[model samples]
Target: MDKRLIKRIAIALCVGPLLWVLFLFYCRPVVALHYSARATESIGFFFMIDYATRKQGMEPGETVVIPTPMFPERDLWILLSFPFDSKDSFEIRKPFSRVDVCIGAGAKVERTEIRHGFFDRFTEPREPCEPPTSKR
Candidate 1:
């Protein structure tokens, strides 16, 4: 191999991983806390958006904190966009269902605070809700 080509290959191998790590450190996406509650009948884990904005199904016990993702690039756009760009600065992504996404958003998601209600009777799981498996 040409000596110059070999040097370029060596530099790339050394710098590639460093660049990737820096990218990861500098590009953290925004994620909000999601609380998953034990639904009635133990049917499945139920989660809500806009915490405390709704009154029903919250019950009064422990809630599983699920760190959910925001719109792609929206989380950082607010902090990086020009000061005059109000729309990009304050918009929040609407909530969607993605068990895997919430579980791995690199945020705290292990806390639980949802409890059983006085009139509600259901068997609570001994462990926190696991991320739903993709059927497809």
Candidate 2:
């Protein structure tokens, strides 16, 4: 190849990965959910999105932390949009039924739960009412 062509190719190679790294680092809005299955039944969950569809199953009383994606482009749009929220659905599957809950955007760590009340005895996992407060 000519010297000018080789120089341009080298520059492109160097800049391509740098741009990708910058995009990945600055663009990805890290959102994660931390939850423990307080109910008596097993719990399974997965993001209802086109890109991420892998199910994560947890046993009764098991604690899990999972990262949820808000595609970089969508996140950008979210920032521009009013309320600055991403309407992402998390499908929680219990033994016989499933429930979809919306997780907000830009939440670094959100504590979730599944509770069983007298009327809804493990019939389904409900969205967390609030994070458990620490006494200490």
Candidate 3:
């Protein structure tokens, strides 16, 4: 084998992945205010969008589960927990990892998971907040 060919092969293998990791880290923000996940919003770079949700009037140590706001599909499953209102941000490209994002202010975050068993995954999506009615 030629020395130049071997060196080029090694460089490509190392540099290719390094560039990819960098790209994922520095991607731009893609906002998702709605509670549903949309696949068409991803750019070539990783989904580095900022996501934030808050529920008011919650008890100090109550457990409330809201829909997982749109994150990079690249993640396997998001381990949701309290980031507290003061610290309300998580890494954009990481997946299948524990994210400590804000839930409610001065409220204790107990658990954040699907309210039911695995079958519940197929059920209708509901926002944690009650919708405004004309009468209210």
C-alpha local distance difference test of each model = 0.33, 0.38, 0.35
- TM-score sort, best first: 2, 3, 1
Number of the candidate with higher TM-score, 2 or 3: 2
Rank candidates, lDDT, best first.
2, 3, 1
Q: Extract clashing residue pairs from model 1.
A: 61-113, 61-114, 61-115, 62-113, 62-114, 62-115, 63-113, 63-114
* Per-model TM-score on C-alpha atoms: 0.25, 0.32, 0.26
Quickly count the clashes in candidate 3.
1
Reference-based lDDT, residue 1, model 1: 92
The candidate with the higher lDDT, 1 or 3, is 3
Encode model 3's per-residue lDDT on 39-62: one tens digit a residue: 222111112223443433333323
Worst 10 residues of 3 by lDDT: 36-45
lDDT value for model 1 = 0.33
- Model 2 C-alpha lDDT per residue in residues 63-134, reported as the tens digit of each score: 443322323333221111112222333333232111212233232123334332323322323545244668
Model 3's alpha-carbon lDDT is 0.35
Superposed by TM-score, candidate 3 places the C-alpha of residue 24 at a distance from the truth, in angstroms, of 0.6
lDDT at residue 23 of model 3 (Cα atoms) = 57
What lDDT does candidate 1 reach at residue 60?
A: 17
Candidate 1 structure quality by residue, lDDT tens digits, 4-123: 999999999999999988755543332222333422221122233333221222221233323333334333211111122112212234332222211212222343223323211123
